[model samples]
Target: MGTHRPRGETARRSRTLSGQIARVLPLLPLAHLDREFDYLIPPEFDEIAKPGVRVRVRFAGRLVDGFLLERVESSDHPGKLGKLDRVVSGEQVLTPEIAELARSVAARYAGTRADVLRLAIPPRHARVEAEERAAPVPIPEVQRDDGAWQRYQHGPAFVAALADGKAPRAVWQALPGEDWTLRLAELAATVVARGQTAVLVVPDARDLQRLAGACTQRVGAVVALAADLGPAVRYRRWLAALRGDAKVVVGTRSSVFAPVSNLGLTAIWDDGDDNHAEQRAPYPHAREVALLRAHESGAACVVAGYARTAEAQALVASGWAHDLVAPRATVRECAPKISAPGDSEQALDRDPNARMARLPHVGFVAARRVLAAGDPVLVQVPRAGYVPGLACASCRTQARCRRCNGPMAVAASQAMVCRWCGVTDPAYRCSACGGQRMRATAVGARRTAEELGRAFPGIQVVFSGGAEVLDAVKPGPKLVVSTVGAEPVALGGYGAALLVDGWTLLGRPDLRAAEEALRRWMAAAALVRPDGEVIVVADPGVPAVQALIRWDPVWHAELQLAERAEVRFPPAVRVAALDGSEEGIVSLLGLAQLPADTEQLGPVPLPASSPDDHEAVRLLLRVPRSAGSALARSLAAAQAARSARKIDAPVRVRIDPIDIG
Candidate 1:
């Protein structure tokens, strides 16, 4: 100890210094990487380098973002590694639950974890330019003598159980009309009143607006997160929820991820709408996301619509949720009187209503009565323009743009414009035949509106669709022509509704065509006054039309379920649609590890108007109910392997796809 050999030499020889010199800090792998990299944890962040949090690091000569998927005690390249720059934020953005959910979704969809995270959470650095104001007013307690509240009283207890963070499943059916929206608002309010957060998702912006308005009245302040909000405003709303300034969030599909503290409930309206499916990468559907959130947060989950989807029905049948439906008598009392074209006792002698018919007699009579009574009537059309497609007047050949084979629309000056590619041609001819004359075969909303204007002169006909028509619509005793999804009548209600062209809806080359058509019919029917009439212009013999005639959606759902069970369609057996080039698909089929007894329906050619194009073909696979999940996992794994092999073709796998042709 006397005259310890040079202090520096002793310090260097000490274990702490030697240990630091030999220590190799492990790198946290990013969500997306061809291979993991070696990174050293900086001494400053060593304590904070917990897995699942974001970290800044130098990689490939640049500082880039990365997620800490795991922490390791040592690295392979202990000598040639740079220390992590810093932890991005102390707050944990990716909780263990959220990380697992994203991972599961990525695996199920054959997508990257980063891609799934991108969908689940908004950009962390994107700041909303707004001062934190007072928090939104708490949801008001609603007291009602009606039986509706009798059910709502139990909502708090249900939500309290969910707050324990266990997936509590429940099915709620509202008596059609404003009541459905109100009941949902009340349930959300009860959750909020308990100092917990809530997320309410609807299928479309209009529905979001409606629900938001209802919630705003009951709950003093709420954040409406939707795509319609300009980027800055949307960011502000998102941040409000993130900062715990807003407890109630109402929005469309993207709002499922709204950061509501202490999430007690996650509710989705019309969970079956295809619009609820995110079109972006990872392609998570709102229903699936809601389910995942419920499971993760131990929140009460409720799926409500005017009519339940087969998926929802399956949930009830499987005992995953309780079916909260209005009593049969209550439903019958509120449902409108339904008239169908197929009623033999009241069949129209005039030309039988066909898919291509302009206006069915029953619908026409209803429209006339409603208009004459000084009330506005809604006329729902399947198509949206004056002429979405054109055919030859002489040879019945379809009119298509020669440039892109897109459907051509005729504008002023007799100009033909391709709706798809927007190519205009002054001189257009039918490609099927060298013909110039074109005929409009089917009626669209625009054409129907025009016809109604002329048929009922001085009656103020209004048209609504993809184009700007909301401003043009006014309260009046006239006809309101609209596309199935674009109906513009206000919430006050319409005198009557005419569901035209049932054949067009039922005959679609899609698996859920019937279900979708019935949903539309029910939506429009819900808009009519309870005493008003609903005329469905179709053969009452058809089960769908018959269900409408009886005003029984449950019957329709049960029948469809039975039929699907018999045919092994969705809700009975899990189905997957794999679409890709013929060769790629064939390879997938060849490599597929489907379970025994799983049926392979087709390598069927996709229906393209042209025969030369063979890039898209669909293979339908039906897995036994017990093996569906496994099959889906296997298909996703196979796709990932194919991608890793550097396959040049594209392969898409859709589980429980909405449309199956």
Candidate 2:
């Protein structure tokens, strides 16, 4: 339990009677009300109103939830101070370390501290708070293989530094055939062995399951805080970490803020996954949060993944972190043999239409060979469902719904429907050619599985994507179709893998197209056996394809970073995206008065929010890396100004948005 509360209330104090003042961060989410307010602390609740505890305070004539940041003997406020209504609970939920981190993140993202706090702290569960914290469990000494460590140039050194209780930051590229979860578990165990805490963050619940299982087997006990594990259960696990009962914590995005004392390491896997980006206020990315937490806590940091992000490359380029990558020989020895379109004249002659074919001859041959070998064949599709998009058969014009102008898609029942509005279009006609016929411009996992099942008869077809995501598939002569990031692990590794619809991902309008495509491809390819083959249905000349062929994601990241620097994009520079009504954006921009070198990318039109609503648009403001902080502050001030004046046309601000498309 926490600090004990008195049985009976003492004499109530007033603002004028006692000078005890509590600086409270009211849970008001308004931009103008982001700062703390001074509240008079009643003598009866003075002990519980200490820093980092939840407290209720009268704000704007009503009691509102707030956190007590600190208490002082006197306040400089000229106006009368409000008294704290009561302390919500005696448990200290927020730590000083996390408080500072929240402030830094808020400033960096041009968001209110209250918004970041909402993301950082879970909702109060009175019953869970009443329960006592768990006792500290002993650490285990599990021996781990050093083979994966020896593959990377600085892997051994990174582990050595961790053992010596020294902070070492590195961006690790996991070699193919490496058990990444087990490797991370071993790393966490090493830090726990030194009586220090380790926090590991992944992208989703399935990943948390794998890492948690591995850590429990290697380390003694770990607190797994997941988003889906009911609020009470999550709070109990979080309290276990906060009370220093668990030395290792493995979870998804929110776990980045785990309050473990004597921190030794902060690590994240797959920094480029879109799932790592939170789609809420403050809009923080898990990789950036993990990095910030590591920096503030002075703990060892590692960004381990099959493919690296441009942001991670920036860390290596700035010398803030070293590159922990395997040598070319080691990569080739561990990675599956990969081939792309136009790799050789013979391949080009054999599969001349490989780039255009959904399932090229090489891919079909590889899948067949793998099936004949009595091993699972993994076919990676880029989209989900039966067909993500449809086009006119006559003119190849993208089919769209007339009602909402949204893209048309085919349901599993073969009904044409609008993806956005969900309205069935039974009598669809092409706007370009006036043809009623439609064809699948892009095949999804289900469509691909249906086709492959026909081609490879007498073999079970397993589908993993959309709502029916399989964690792992049993190894056999079966065809496994999956969407990227949803590829199920095959026991003993896949015999062959086919990355189809490469052009769809590579040709996206987003600047991160190539980088994202490589990340998706490499993530699926790495699941193949060392001796297996990977066939990519993309042009071999593309850098992403070549990188996959050579299993060299580092080169791709470095190239991406250089390109971004040349063009002044994220990591090389900072961009703040303003998305909302045109008037709101214009008003915010005028009020902001951004720096001299700010480059305005767009006031491009976004779809109408509703028939009665104003047309929305997005404007991107770019500045030099050195001006990022200034930009954040300026935008925040402008937002606050608008809020203070009660402007109804609201503009949403996001810093370094993960997807600019």
- Among the numbered candidates, top lDDT falls to 2
Give the clashing pairs for model 1.
Answer: 165-298, 166-298, 342-540
List TM-scores for all candidates, in order.
Answer: 0.79, 0.89
Per residue, candidate 1 scores C-alpha lDDT tens digits across 236-270 of 77767866778789999888877666888899998
Q: Encode model 2's per-residue lDDT on 59-172: one tens digit a residue.
A: 777778989888777555545666788999988888899999999888989999899999889998899888866666767775756666887897887888888899999999
Candidate 2 stretches with Cα past 4 Å from truth are 1-19, 142-147, 385-440, 609-614
Which ten-residue region of model 2 has the weakest summed lDDT?
Answer: 1-10
Model 2 error, position 110 (Å): 0.1
Error of 2 at 595 (Å): 1.4
Best candidate, TM-score? 2
TM-score of model number 2: 0.89
In order, what lDDT does every prediction score? 0.68, 0.83
